[model samples]
Target: MMDALFITLQVILAVIAVYQFVFSLFGMYRKKKKAHFPATKSFAVLVAAHNEEQVVGALMENLKNLDYPKELYDVFVICDNCTDGTADIVREHGIQACVRTNTNLRGKGYAIEWMLKELWDMPRQYDAVVMFDADNLAAPNFLSEMNDDLSGGARVIQGYIDTKNPEDSWITAAYGISYWYINRLWQLSRHNVNMANFLGGTGMCFETKMLKEIGWGATSLVEDLEFTMRSVQKGIYPKFNYDAKVFDEKPLTFKASSRQRLRWMQGHFTVARRYFFPLLWQSIKERNLVKFDLALYSVNVYIVLLTFLMTAIMGIDAAVFNGPNIANIYGYLPLGLSFVAVGASILTFMAAMALEKVTFKKVYAYLILFPIYLISWYPITFYAFFTQNNKQWSHTEHTRVVRLEEVVQSKQV
Candidate 1:
């Protein structure tokens, strides 16, 4: 009975994982027609900076040269409790800067909340608000695409996120690969079906009315996911803009990337705990498949950790029951389920590369390390699940200055 129960549990996880994998596979075939909208909405660009002196100025410069009417958009920078020259740099460029000083209210969520309130009190109201990190460089036509989308009637939108220094280290390479995979396989797949897209922390836009209605109440470490999952309950879906590209600076070292990913894992699990049950119940009660999809996607970290734990328990049983010189259960047990998931992941990334025509030798070389990076997530997920309360946000340092032109040329790889 014990063995049967364990086998049944593994079978359940394998089923859910396989279902998600198949959906992702199905999402690869994007057939939806994109309706172009006129470019006319006014936007307020928001940047929340914390000691980002190294790269904030470059971001402002990139904004000033965007291919859109100057009058259509304005930039705002929030130097949140920075003891550095981030504020000075913003002021030197004659940009609107807000210096926040409340130490208790830390992280990007608080900074965004403060800025939204400030924007609300201003004399002129913006039709939409777009967000970017201090280290991000916008593609010259990013705003134009966003403007087109906003004019066409998409209320909330997440732009494409690319990396700046993909060749800086193996970690950066893996990070870049992860983004491209998610961008092509995950977001585009959802968009292909006219479903909601998940918002990254940066390179996203929200309608002014939506922001006012919901407020930036998602103060978790991963504010973007928090906001996306919570807001879907109200039937408002976020859309995607494939052309609005923003090059983000990825961490160049494992230690740095681990800390950054740890926060993400912690925040993902935390938000899942709070919203998954309610959202799942609502999805079934109302027959809303979009919300159901979002609920399943949000709990991915938990699913992975659970898989490892169940596999571990099986190993323990193999040891205790077999006594001395116990035989391995690699073939008999469902450990192959994990490998199947990993194989599906590799195929997903390879397919994304093919879709983008990424034949670059260096990118292919870097992609070989993706399985290693994917496996490392298991340890980090376990660590984060046990230690989620130490939520003092750790900011990933960024100093790379790669621009959109490099991204366009395909030489950054």
Candidate 2:
């Protein structure tokens, strides 16, 4: 009876996975409609950098060349406890860069909060505030599209972030493909159905007033997720804008990738424990549909972890009890099918790539190794929950650099 019950729950979760897949497909269809709105507002572009001396100059150059008028957009770089020349490079270029040193408050979230406080003190009131990491290179039209979305009544907008080092190594290639698929399909789908979307740390724009009302503050390790969930709970779902693109570097080496993934895993586990119950309770008490969405998004990491555990248990059962020792045929069949379904779901990343118009030739080489990358998260996530190492922000290294002209040429063919 216990085995049957386990098998039943597996089948039910598998069905929910299928539902999410379908939801993603519909999102892709809806994304084809161009986001249209007038651009007649000013913006404050906030960049948080820590020891990014090598790439800060280039990022400033890219910001200078943005298509938006200089008077309309102001770029602010916060050098949070940097020992390097990150602040020097930005200030050297004549940009308004601030050097902040706080031993007590350390992390990108704290830096952002400080910057927000500075903005509030000034007489200037920006229509929107867009955040980006130090390494990201914005497209010329990034601000223009973000302005459109803000004018169209979106409180928050998440732009697409593509990798600059996709062709450098297999690890980087896999990471790049996963990012592209998620932004183009998963996020686009969720936005289409009015569901909450996870905020990719950089390239997200928030309305100035909304940020003020919500209070721009995040001390959590995964400040992006915490901020996103809080916004959703308040009934402000972030809109996805695929037309606004930001290019960033992928971790070139496995050591670097592991460190980055470890932080993400730890942050996810922390947020799930912190917000899951509150969101669930809020959903039940208020009968709020968006509250339920926020709760589901918060618990996704746990769900993935659960799915992996259940898969392992069923695999053991199939090997030991399927042939002669057990007469429970129903238990084996459903669990076996569940494993197949899970395997197939992992392949959906490939399908998502095809839908995004990423060339099959460009992605085929890394396809076979994709599953290995997916499974790697299991160990990191497990360790994150158990050990919880480095709750403080450990920024990933970004050395890869691709020009906007290169990205345009690649897309042209």
Best by lDDT: 1
Tens-place lDDT digits, model 1, residues 123-235: 99999999999999898888888887877878889999987777778888888888888888888878877888999999999989988998889888999999998789888
Distance from true position, residue 413, model 1, in Å? 7.8
The prediction achieving the highest TM-score against the true structure is 1
TM-score of 1: 0.92
TM-score, cand. 2: 0.90
**Cα lDDT computed for each candidate against the true fold:** 0.84, 0.80
| Clash count of each predicted structure | 0, 1
- In model 1, where do residues sit more than 4 Å from their true spots? 1-5, 30-33, 316-342, 411-413
Error of 2 at 7 (Å): 3.7
Q: Which consecutive 10 residues in model 1 have the weakest lDDT in total?
A: 322-331
